[model samples]
Target: MGPVNKNTFDIGPALHRAILGAGGHDVAISDSMLASNGAASTREAKAFIADARDAGQTPLKASEVEQIHAMPDKAAAKLVALQIDLDPARSEMVAIAQIEGVWCRAMIDNVPLDARLPIYDFKTCENASPEACQKTILNYGYDVQAEHYRQVWQAATGEDRVFRFVFQEKTAPHEVCVIELGAGTLLIAGKKIARAREMWDKCMQANQWPGYPLGVKRVDPANWAIERWPKR
Candidate 1:
C-alpha cells in the first residue's frame, strides 16, 4: 500500500477503533482535521498527518470521543448474549485459507465462543434499526457478502455456518441491531455468488477480461416513465 491518504476528519475509522477494538487499521487523524468544525485544513493538516504517521496514533476530537463513549452499553451487552465479546485479544479471529484453490480471507469482528452461535461481523452505519438496515443490506449487496463469508467458514470447517451482521449507528445514541438474512434472501445471494464465480473462472481460463459491449449503446427510459406519459 502507498502512503496513507487522509480522510476529511476521519471520524468513521476512529469510531471503529473505539467500538470494535479494530486496531492499526485506521489512518491517523490530524489537528486541523478535527478543527474548523470538521472543515478542510491547510498546512496545519499536513503537519498533523506527518506527526500522526510518525507516532502511529489517530487521536479523536473530544466531541468525537464523547460520541463514542456515549454509545449505548446495550451493544456490548448484545454481543455478550450472542456468545461474542468486545475483547479483541480473546475474540478477534481471522480465517485465511484456500476454498477449493480459491484463496479466501475474512476478519471475524466478534468470534462466537460458543459452538451453537452464528458467525458475527460488526458494521457501523448511519442507522441500526432493522427497517433502515434491511434496505442497506439489499442495496449494498450485503447478502452476497454474508454468503461469501459463510463459504469461507465452510472451507475452513467443512460445515455450513449461519452468518449475521451486527450494525451500530455512527451518530448520537449509537443504537445497535443484530440481523440475519432470511433463507430466501440468502438463496438469491448464493445464486448470484455462484454465477459470479463461474464467470471469474471462465475469464481466467480465457485470459480475456472483457469490458463493455463493443458497440454504441442506446439509453432507454424506464417502462414506468413511458406509462406515466399521458395516453394520447
Candidate 2:
C-alpha cells in the first residue's frame, strides 16, 4: 500500500536486529511475554538503551561508531530537517505519537496500501552517539517503533505510504545530519494485508502455519481479490 503501512511491518525485526547486531547481544524481549505480563523485552531494552545512550550513561561501542560510515549521505541530510520539524514546543502527547499494534508479535508481513500523509522514518548512524541525536531530533532508534506502528496502521486502514529512512551523521558537539533511502516505497500495504489473510486462511485450512522465513511467506492474491491476481 503506502510507506507508512510498509514501515510498520519492518520496524520490529529491523530494530531487534539492529540492537543485537550493533550491541553484539540480544536486547529484545519476546512479544508474546509483553502481552501476557507487564515485563520488558528486547523492544523495551532497545528503548531503554536509546534513552540511556541519550543520557550519556552507557558508553558507545566501536562497531556502532563504525556503522555510521555505511549510511547513505543524502539520508543523513534529511534527518536534520526531520529533527527540526519535530523539535518545536508542543504537548507531550502530540509530540509523542502512540504507535498502534504489533504488540502481539515481532514478525511482520510486507503490506502495501495508499495513505494521505507520507510517514518518515529515521535511523541513526551506528557511531553517531545519543547526544548527537538529541541535538537533531528524537533518538534515531525510534525508527523501528515508527515502522512497526505503521504496519499496524496499514492493517487497520488501507492506505499507501512512503517510508523514508533518514540516516544521520555526527559532525561535532552540536551538529548532526540525515539522508533518505533511495527506495521509492517500502511495500504496498493492501497487497501485504491480503497476503497475511491468505496465509492465515491456508493455515486454518491445513491446520498449520505455512513454513516460511519471516516476510517470505507466499500468499495468493487471487484467493482474496477479483481481477488480476498476484503470480507466485
lDDT of 1 by residue, 1-232 (tens): 7566655346665665656765553343544455566743556766765676567666455566566666636577776776565565534577776754556777666555555567777778998889999999998998988888787777776657778888998776677888988889889998988787777777878998999889888899999889988774
Q: For residues 55-114, could you state the per-residue lDDT of candidate 2 as single tens digits?
A: 533322333333433332233344445542322121011122222221223222222222
The TM-scores, one per candidate, come to 0.79, 0.30
Could you tell me which 10 consecutive residues in candidate 2 have the lowest summed lDDT? 87-96
Using TM-score as the measure, the top candidate is 1
Model 2 CA lDDT for position 229: 52
| Whole-structure CA lDDT of model 1 | 0.71
RMSD of each: 3.7, 16.4
